[model samples]
Target: MADRDWSIETLHDDYRQALRIDAVHYDSNTDLQRIRVLENARFGRFMTLDGVVQTTEGDEFIYHEMMTHVPLLAHGHATRVLIIGGGDGGIAREVLRHPSVTHVTMVEIDAGVVEFCKEHLPSLSAGAFDDPRLNLVIADGAAFMRESDAEFDVIIVDSTDPIGPGEVLFTDTFYGHAQRRLRPGGILVTQNGVPFMQGDELTNTMRAFKALFGDATCYLSTIPTYAGGPMAMGWGTDGDARHVSLETLQTRYAASGLACRYYTPEVHKAAFALPGYVARLMP
Candidate 1:
């Protein structure tokens, strides 16, 4: 491929952060939306969905580890997992790291994202799709949760920012369905965008979650590629929210025996230590 300049901007009404790519590995518009696989000097291989940078080679572990390990470890023992919209497979890979996760039913709206990422951005999936535990379902996540009777011990909403197709997943209607699908003591986690830049996103999610679960909160993790202070992951469950202790996390981390670059037992506790500014955004 010839060298070409590719400029992509984050998806926000007012945010101006953008990335200039050195090379384009793949670019196409699927039935769902536009997708781009680009190589950058700083972030290396990364993919953007509908112009928003989803994940990159440099800092994906931060997002994936925090997203997966937090709720899984907090839940203590999750044999069945449901992942919504993480076509990149990073979330699934991390979920399967836990020996207790016997099955993971991943529902991605766009099959194109999965195929393209598998072919060009192979590192993101990291062979998680091939794992026998992964039951990859291509369908609208909200519809799947509403129609299916299957229950999950942990339902992870690894969705993109609430836009386009993702808009539905953030609504209260979908969240209610997700809550109903969870087994007793199960937890629901979501990708609530950067609180600094997308405060409304966090606030709205917390409102809906709090209404359904009564125990809703947000956690923080810094992903450089997201170009914000810290990204927020929405947490909700009917279970005890105060159960996440340092000792518990440490015990779970040691038992898993999986080495991770970003998720540490200590960091797990710290992620929920939201700053006052971010806390103000919560309901």
Candidate 2:
């Protein structure tokens, strides 16, 4: 196999992680960002946006399953869901697994990423886009939530790191808007970066979450493609969601009958048990 290297510009440091690719299937400058799809022997087919690996066929289940299941299972009866910035459709695929989810409104800022992923990264989405319950909205996510009168049972911010187009989603004002758009007992989850390298990202999001929801916490998940220690995910809600019992989680897990590769009921309960270094990042 020939050597085709790809470099990722992570958020915290100047150094970039290089990936060895076997070949490039698609590489284009979209309206919003530069997107690339490559086949690798180790990682399989992977997609990157602006030099950041968004998802790979090999380990995508870890991030997608944990990010979607932890909050949904905790909420117990989330019938409606809102996803912001998951243009790759990995989050939507997981969210649709729950039979209780009747409607999913996905707000993505760029249509290019979605189209590209649908064409080149088909396994990542797994036909989730064609689901009848999905409502695809091509617009700015922050602005879309601010203008909409609808409320969701769960709101998930599956955003990129706090930079470029994804920077505004991490703002306090955007959090407030999301809070207002949620039902009284609704849960809100966000993708905070790796705490070891992006401590400020977790802390800053915790500050915003604290201001809006009294019960705000974070959970951890290990993803090999992320290239750091365990990744942190933001969890916030007004009710007793973060304190859900293991029995309740197990009950919900059994009721859903969703077989996941990375997210087990026990793992959902334990992901909240953060390490000392990561716990210190919590506000």
Candidate 3:
């Protein structure tokens, strides 16, 4: 067996998680960020951007499923979808599974991340890049939201943490623009960081969401790679999707026939139940 080197994730200053790298699949500086695809024993192939773990082949289904399914299924009839910053195509892969979805406009800042992930971590995308319904746009996500006249039924912001290229996506201006691009009852979901470690991140997003939308809250999902308890998925909409009955969710889930690993009708409802500590952070 070849010798392994450990890749330490420097996401948290006080605590860090290290993954054993069996081999380096791809490592280079992309136009926007430093991207690395590493092979690991337990997590399989994983991708990191700027020394932070983005996704892995092993547990990608958990994050992708929750991020895409919760909002789409709750909305019950989301045909047009807008995805910002999901370069790995994992969110698109899950969104396309619903046959009701007609068009998917995926605006990614770095085309290199899409191309590299498609080659190195193909399973995460699982042929999503080749889908005809997907209209891939290479542009800044915040800029697209500001300038485009197009609207969507659901907008999923599959972004990185509030730093680097993704910093713009977390701003109040970006959230306001995203709300404007949504069709009347449209839902917006964002990748908020783990509340345990990044409490301020969730708080700032909630504050923005509350000011912009009628229903602003977050749901939780635990991904092993992400570390520090459960990660929060920000939810915002002026519509009643957040109040959709469990029976309604079950009907929608059954009709879609989605085979999800982490997201189910029951889990979807339970995810919205925030712990006291996390709820205190919300505006």
In terms of lDDT, which candidate is strongest?
3
Stretches off by above 4 angstroms in model 2 are 1-4, 8-11
Cα lDDT tens digits for candidate 3, 1-283? 2223888898889998999898899999976789999988999999999989999999999999999999999999999999998999999999999999999999999999999988898898899989999999999999999999999999999999989999999999999999999999999999999999999999999999999999999999999999999999999999999889999999999999888888999999999999999999998
TM-score of each: 0.96, 0.96, 0.98
Q: Where is model 1 more than 4 Å wrong at Cα?
A: 1-6
What lDDT score goes with residue 96 in model 3? 97
Q: Give per-residue CA lDDT, model 1, range 1-283, as digits (tens).
A: 3223655574666766656688889989987798999888888988988778888988998999999999999999889999999999999999998999999999999989999989998988889999999999999999998999999999999998888899999899999999999999999999998899899999999999889986889889999988768999999898984367889888888999979998898888888889999999988
Q: By how many angstroms RMSD does model 2 differ from the true structure?
A: 1.6
Model 2 Cα lDDT, one tens digit per residue, 43-110: 99888888888888999999999989998998999999999989999999999999999999999999
Candidate 3: where are CA atoms >4 Å away?
Answer: 1-4
Residue 46, candidate 3: alpha-carbon lDDT? 94
User: Would you list the rank order by lDDT, best first?
Assistant: 3, 2, 1
